[model samples]
Target chain A: MNLRTLLEEKKSSIVKKWVHVIFEQYPPDSTNFFLTQKDRFLNPVGHAISEGARDIFNALVDDSEPEKFYPLLNDIIKIKAVQDFSPSVAISFLFLLKKVIRVEAGAEIARRNLTPELEALESRIDQLILLSFDIYSKFRERIFEIKNDEFRRMTFRLLQRANLICEIEGEKTTPGEETVITNK
Target chain B: MAVQKPEELSKVVYTFPSTPWMDTPVEIKKGIFCWGNKEKSLKAVGFPNPRQWSVTDEDWKLPDNWKEIFIEGLRERVDKYRSFRLFLDICVRCGACADKCHFYIGGGDPKNMPVLRAELLRSIYRKYCTTSGKIMGKVAGARELTTSVIKELWYYAYQCTECRRCSLFCPYGIDTAEITILIRELVNLLGLNIEWIAGPVANCWKTGNHMGLLPHTIIDIVSEFKEAIYQVTGLKVDLSYNRKGAEILFVHPSGEYFDPNGNVTFMGYMMLFHEIGLDVTLSTYSSEGGNFGFFTSNEMAKRLHSKIYAEAKRLKVKWILGGECGHMWRVWHQYHNTWFGPVDYLEEPVSPITGTKFENAKSNKIVHITEFTADLIRHGKLNLDPKRNDKYVVTFHDSCNTSRAMGLFEEPRYIIKNVCNNFYEMPPQTIRENTFCCGSGSGLNASENMELRLRGALPRGNAVRHVRDKFGVNTLANICQIDRATLQTLVDYWAKGVAVRGVHELVGNALVMKGEKERTTDLRGDPLPGKEGE
Candidate 1:
């Protein structure tokens, strides 16, 4: 069978596998609920993961335009970006996509004359994976910036009780500057 | 292992150390706080102690008399609001409210505990205001008003969603919400207002809306909404604006006019009004039913809330109908009469369509849109087909204010159940008076406070997650505009597939308008269940 036709045929199963692989990072209890629930509305996390995975797979199959993937990738990655995944593990679904595709493609590809097409498809996936890191990094950066603001807010009470609201008034101060109250 | 989900956050993994909360200094943590207010936004509204400042600065540049101003402010508030004095003096360290605070429940932070949060301010109140605090000092549970104390108040006050769930459980009925509002008021006096809230308050004071949408901008947006209705349904929907002598003048949170889902809900309002041919006018002057000042101070709340009745009187409307909002109703129900009351010019609000006398709001002379719509549905006035909303298995999230402050329990749910075929309730504890705050409420919805918001949202998120696991419920219908903006982010982080929607948005989708084209999609432009699968 042609590579494109194989990819098209196995897309649903591939998206499912990719979602399961991504969800494995969560606790088993959570994963059970995230995976077992089928109702789209009730199993929102699972449904979203499926929908997001399906969109990414469809974009990958199109191959006509790769930019279509980012918007879809962004919607999912943003959730990941705010979620508790490490930088590498969070966007690592991009890597898992390759495995799902290869596993579904099967070893029969070696006998076929689809080597060039397979290599080209794999390389496109590689490039998209590289771009996915940028989205992951940017979102992580935003979360960091947000955390720094919160951290500073902790010491805000100390600053006020110490009579610090007006002495620094004339001086230009940058926003979200981390100042810990060391005063006893 | 990564804590990808709230359930994965082990109970043993403590949010705050077991060390004595009072003895230890508050260590700043990530994912639990945000930078303080901008100086510009504070100065715009003529807030006290206004000066250019940043939350990151080591120095806040306080006036020498800043301490005196705060004390006087406290004394004045104590005299003015009896609740303020009683909340401060009546607490006996009973732990009834400790576990009830959503912040403490979700974050596991001791300070998030309503008792501890009140203590942060109460210590100072005891210090300067009481004689024992002056004499015994630390021994009497009183601490001097130090920069650290002020900073601690800022940290803990914002952490509180001020939903008053804690107060409901308090033995002495010490309302931490009222206390928190006062702390924020005192904080605002020091120009420590967060930009997210201050900016909106400034805009609303000038332009009559939180988002700073001017009169012309509102007109253009409403006109565009009309155009979109025409384009989609092949029917004209012309909403009136600032029209004097109209039977009813409608006001909703400005967030509804701008946010995507909110706009869809507003469209639902338009469709309902248009279908019924109700003589309702949308007022550009009283465009916002929300009062951000309620989050800051009673005076600010009074200033902002004044626009409603003033505009109603100016426009000469018989009565007013308020749209779906949480805190707006809080202000309307509890504070409006106390603040800018005796709206005697406006007659008692009775729905012209269903002829339902809203006895609950007849005294206030303003009716909640949910009350109006639910009444309409009760009278069989609306041509609703529940099949239109078959795409959604929905659940209702009673916004904290509407739940606790107004007790608007069944009104919105009545509309949702009648409009949608499938409706599921979360744990009984999580709905009605016991409902959890969206966490981003009371001006904590700023992006800078994302982590605090996520952790604080955990209780509600976990509850919704439960229903999502049990039932096929994908949509969370709420009445608050803050929920419209913040709950979306909350759901995105905690539960991905679930979407946040206003109750009326569902009502509009189910509403079969006269002479409309065959409906293909809901108000949000999502395809109908039968229309799909083509």
Candidate 2:
């Protein structure tokens, strides 16, 4: 298969596997706090990814433009790579997904008796999510070079706005005092 | 009312000493201040009020109230300029402007860095204006004002010749001289100004010119020179003054009225105009073409510059011809067009003789003495005897403001080559945009800053020595009156065998009038009249 087709198929399988993992991580208990907090925090992450994906898909459909979608996908992979998310961090995310999938699989087992086929599906889902995060992390550096001064300045300003870089209180000495001493 | 005698004034009132050096000989000091206690010191004898002087060692210890009043006035003046904000905001500190500064390159001081020099004003601006500065202070590299800061400002502001060389190299096209002017204005407001500068400025305000010569005294000096011209060339030139309805008002630096080298150039200007039969009259009221206030404060600068328009109005002249003074042209060419408004009484400068319109304000309306002479020669209007100035090998010293700021590179050289037998140039960078100062320019020539002045003169002195040793150049010619005066002092003390003269002085020496007697004296005080063999 061509790279584009192979990548699209791989992305589709990874997304399906992640969705199953998310379901397993949240149990069906009526008062589950993790599920309640998921909508507040994790939902935004999901919403942002979905929005990015939808924009890429729309650009592809409108002009049959592969150049447009390819860069966006590359950028997401680059961000994942340079962040140097430890293999453990990726595995932890997979483990969380595994828990959600297990709960869904448990519900299925309860509705009908436990089966070997259901357990095998859960293992396959776990392996797929882990592999996708690993691949994304490896290609992060090349993605960063696409965004130059404008993008860097924008991103820097955004991070500053978010209080990612700490700021200290004003100095006790006034400007007049420092300049006078230095110039003298 | 009778004017007060120089002796009647207190010695303390008039004496302003420049910076002292560690190893300055007592003899050198004595020679520089030869006027001594007779109230003859140029710095001391000029001031009207002697008792108001305070001899404080520190600049900060001056009257606090006067300082506050002056600073407030300066702030008001600077606040009126909206372009200053753009200049303050635009510098990227790329350091491209460092090598462009003659002082910075010659001295090798980091503070002389153009961006850093401009930052002296910019940092103060940020402290008071920006939000980040108001909140974070030194984290944003802002600081408050203090006594030492004021002193440092004076030191660096004086270092700049206000030549505008840095403006050409700046990517954003910011002129640091504008900042230097602002700092000087602010300093003047504080009453923490140099005495030598204030003395001349006050004189320019009280008298018509900076030298404090009375109308009759000026008449006597001009009449003496006119007699000298007649004795030499047998030409009775009409050099009148304060006469109403003159077609053109001719202005020159007051230094030209007394100095021998300056007189040669003045005589050259007279001979050329007399030959052309141009209707020009010298102004006894405002004879000084050079503005010392340009190196000091804008209020004082405006006060001194206003006299030009006032004199023109008084005389009903159509145009004014500026003589060969560096800063004089800088003020007229760059600032006069902006500061003086609706000058409808005078038409834009059109050469009354050639009928050619001068559009470039810097070089056009205000013609250099060299350009005027060169143009005359180009048109074959005057009969020049090039052998008259053949006594010594000559080289030209292009003043930075003229050659670099005004792009007057060829006219002076062309005039020199046409008049003198052997003409040479100093090493490439030392002559044109990179020409060194005589160390006494920008008003630092006063006896007060002898050490700094000597240090600054080193580069120019060395450059002259190069030409003297390599080409056996016995005479150096320049167009700026200040260059003549300052280099006279430098060459006398440092370069013993070489002498400096104005370019016009050489031209005038070579000039032979129609059916007139041949002139005898060359610009170097040499008797070149009948020495056709040498």
Candidate 3:
């Protein structure tokens, strides 16, 4: 009748369901690829999503320390952040964990009169969702930063190499920084 | 009673997903990546990106004579590199390599596909070289070389890791990596380059290494490792330097001098040499074994790699022993003689400890470290106890260059098996000749285009995650500096708890040093397996 033990016991199956949900988020054409190709080399994005989802779930299940767990959560979110998903859609998987736990273990929770205990778990999921928002936003912001910086290499490279008159701000590149500015 | 609705229970596919660009013309935008090479480097190597031009802009600021330059460069390459000419003419466009590229698979940009990436250059080749293209332009799979096409080539060329996996599946055995190199060469005529590559090629030309570390700093790095050796083994291992008339002149990838895990591999080399009592000297002049210039162009790669034979002749060593590296092996095994050959000065490489003739490297006079070590193990020259590295659940990542270019698949694995008790291979498709790049090869490992790099690395990381889940693999061992630097990020990002190391670094941990202390920690100062509580 112990709902906590029941939740802990079904962790792997709950993780599988969470992974399946994330795989479905891939394109309709790629859905078969993500599902059928178990080889990591053949279907890497699928493997990453599934593996990353499992890591976050296990970390949540074991109640690992935040110091030990945030990095794991970041690893997964960073990939999704840079992908085509909008920020909300990128981190929606963190919310999927809540749905997975409820769907997988809802019967066990109600049968044992574990609403208050399960609510505690649900709130923890909410806390993780908030944390994931911070991680995904930071990651998305970084992609934009890289985009601006990568294309800007032409100015510094061309001006200096061509012997065009130019100016530099400083030694190390700061955010919103340029190494060169051409006269014309 | 609380059964979920069927609609809610089923998988919810999101709208606005990043779809692959299937036959869609590329849009030149700042949001998409085109990593720029540095100016000093472009100037150092004598290339074109000299006048600042942005990839995001509608104009690349090409000179009035750009058409003349393209024709000249194309003609020069076709005349010189038969492979280039053949690759341009022979593609049937069967699309065997369409889904083969790691970048294409991960990024979803169809242009990142090997077939299309090559076609970017091949279409121009068709227009200029073929008689049919002159008759039926744009219809015979030929497109005019517009600024948009040039910009598209710039974006996708650097995206390719030059892994050459696509070459294996082609019916004609067409190598896209060759097309990538030639296009990289063609772009250089316009002075366009990514800094990660041009910076290293420039530095290697001037400072004898990629990081621009001066000669004195290199000795200081070796001195620091000596201190670690003294701390671990008690007896100070005899560290030789630039010794002329030595029996062996050992060269390693310059990244080993300072990269965190690379230092571990360097220390492993020192301990192994000391343990085997081999008389060898490290070269300060030819410090770098791998050629960054190789990625720049054939001439630049040849220029950089020429230093090794020159150093070996200067030192008058009996033979040359190379350290654990990927592209260095590629250059040594495949292109050494063709680039800078007639190395008739030095004698053939033979292991002093094992007395193996090194028949494989007899003509080249350069022996791979894995080959030497595996030979030593075959003769039972090592006093290894595999239990020393018992903490690790090891897996070998067959570096793309060594696997594809050299076919060196077994020697490194033989050494890894001897040193570590637990070692697992990634999925069959991911290892050996079919290995995915570390995602940042060919000078694309820039901090700015991490989106491209991460997408490129997704396949490699995905395979790492499989073993970490299935077999509890925690250490990814390979013989690559780029892999060492980039896979650290990859493992941390995709498969946490897994660490990356050189194959030889594991060997050093297992080496039973002579007159050594009761060691408590292995290299990198991690506790030895049995000495964990100490």
> What DockQ does every candidate get?
0.04, 0.00, 0.14
Writing each residue's lDDT as its tens digit, candidate 1 over B120-181 gives 88888888889999999988899877676677787787788789999888877777898989
The TM-score obtained by model 1 is: 0.74
TM-score of candidate 3 against the unseen true structure? 0.79
DockQ for candidate 1: 0.04
What fraction of the native interface does candidate 3 get right in terms of contacts?
Answer: 0.24
Listed per model, the TM-scores of chain A against the true chain A are: 0.73, 0.34, 0.81
Whole-model Cα lDDT of every candidate shown, in order = 0.77, 0.60, 0.77
Q: Candidate 1's interface RMSD, please?
A: 11.2
Ranking by DockQ: 3, 1, 2
Q: Which tens-of-lDDT digit does each residue in B284-305 have in candidate 2?
A: 7777888888877665677788
Q: Which ten contiguous residues of candidate 3 chain B have the minimum total lDDT? A: B14-23
Ranking of candidates on lDDT, top first: 3, 1, 2
lDDT of 3: 0.77
Report the lDDT tens digits of candidate 3 across residue range A1-184.
5656776799889988887777666554445556666665676666667777778777766777666668777767867765655555677787777788889988888888888887877777788888888887787666555444434432333343355634453244321254445565
Q: Model 3 RMSD to the real structure? A: 9.8
Task: Summarize candidate 3's per-residue lDDT along B1-534 as a digit string, tens digits.
Answer: 012356744655443255543335676433236456656777886766476665656777787887778878898889888888999998888977876788766755557768878888888887887888867987887778776677777777777888888998999999888899888888878777777788889999888888776778788778878898888778687778789989999988888875667888989999999998899998777989878888878888888988888888898999999888878888888788787665788887778887789887877888888889999999999889788899999999988888998888999999999999999999888899988888878777666667677677778887888899999999999998888866776566667789889988898888988788877888867678877777
What is the TM-score of candidate 2?
A: 0.64
**Model 3: runs farther than 4 Å from truth?**
A1-40, A46-79, A85-135, A138-184, B1-25, B28-34, B53-59
